[model samples]
Target: MDDPVRAFLEANHGAIMTTLKKDGSPHVARVVIGLVEGKLWSSGTRKRVRTAHVRRDPRATLCVLSEDNPWAWLGLETTVTILEGPEAVDQNLALYRALAGEPEGLDEYRRAMTAEERLVYEFTIHKAYGMH
Candidate 1:
């Protein structure tokens, strides 16, 4: 992603992500996104249907919108890679910090994430279009 696009995404955390279902229908959900390691990242759990969908189909799209202006948005065609286990926990923490800053009780947070079976959806931008 370019600097302007990255900055726009940073300023706008809320987006609607599209993933494909088993029948090839679109499943859209609101997600909080952030740039992590030069890629867009969102946290999910193993139990969620979205997780299953993404795992099954790596292709996805994210329409990131600006909270302040309805006219401003960015649409990203991306491919997702699921991260789990210890590496996922570390990446998830990095994502959390990137989006929301540092959290209190880091250890507790990690424990909770592990208990919840948290995973990270790492998005590689394939194409993008929108008004920055």
Candidate 2:
């Protein structure tokens, strides 16, 4: 396992397209990610379809490929764990601040979110593979 993969993920916590199955086929969609305590964290709005699918099945695969180098890819297969309530909300806010360069007004943005509106999910990273 390369340590840089984790570092890369933390530094570039952008949208990653996770693939799951529906009706014996595959479905891929982009999602925002946060790195909290070395685990991959994400959330979904109530309107997002992925949230519903995840509830039904927690298994997912996340792929992050380098734009400048196709050969360089980081992939992980893991089970999703949903985190709800106040603790999750605070963790998400902290993650956002860390990955988003600690931008100004972040405190206000985090403060504006209600406890119910924030849904945090983490991937345990059961297995990870990559090529540099």
Candidate 3:
């Protein structure tokens, strides 16, 4: 259809639970994500399994279930880029706050997080498709 990757993300902007094995195989879990600058972004602690997989392999696939038809699904293959610096954190925090609808005191929460503790991973869409 019309760029299923962007369509899927626009329809569902939430965390997407992704699976990545040490061997480089990947699986995707639907999760809430924040969209900014035409990219899909998510945050997680370093202790999480997905975080570990991303650390090993930045390539990931994301899938979102279709609401109009439960039998349908959209999938995207993307390259993940992990942001771990101050500036990147700020940008990601702004996007996160906007997506979360937390207007007040988000800056404080973002400031409390350390650069490493806050993982801002961006998924660059490479290919996308869907099936019904």
Highest-scoring model, TM-score? 1
Every candidate's CA RMSD: 1.0, 2.7, 3.1
lDDT scores of the candidates, listed in order: 0.91, 0.69, 0.68
Candidate 3 lDDT over residue span 48-96, tens digit each:
6777787788788777666566767767677888876666667667676
**Which should have the higher lDDT, number 1 or number 2?**
1
lDDT of 2 by residue, 72-117 (tens): 7678887888776667557777667666756567657666555347
**lDDT value for candidate 2?**
0.69
For candidate 1, which ten residues in a row score worst on lDDT?
83-92
Q: Which residue pairs in candidate 1 have backbone atoms (N, alpha carbon, C) closer than 3 angstroms, thus clashing? A: none
Summed over model 1, clashes come to 0
* TM-score, model 2 to reference: 0.78
Q: Which stretches of model 3 miss by more than 4 angstroms?
A: 1-4, 24-30, 67-69
TM-scores of the models, in the given order?
A: 0.95, 0.78, 0.75
Worst 10 residues of 2 by lDDT: 11-20
Instruction: Residues 28-101, candidate 1: write the lDDT tens digits.
Output: 99999988867789999999889989889999999999989999999999999998988888888999999888
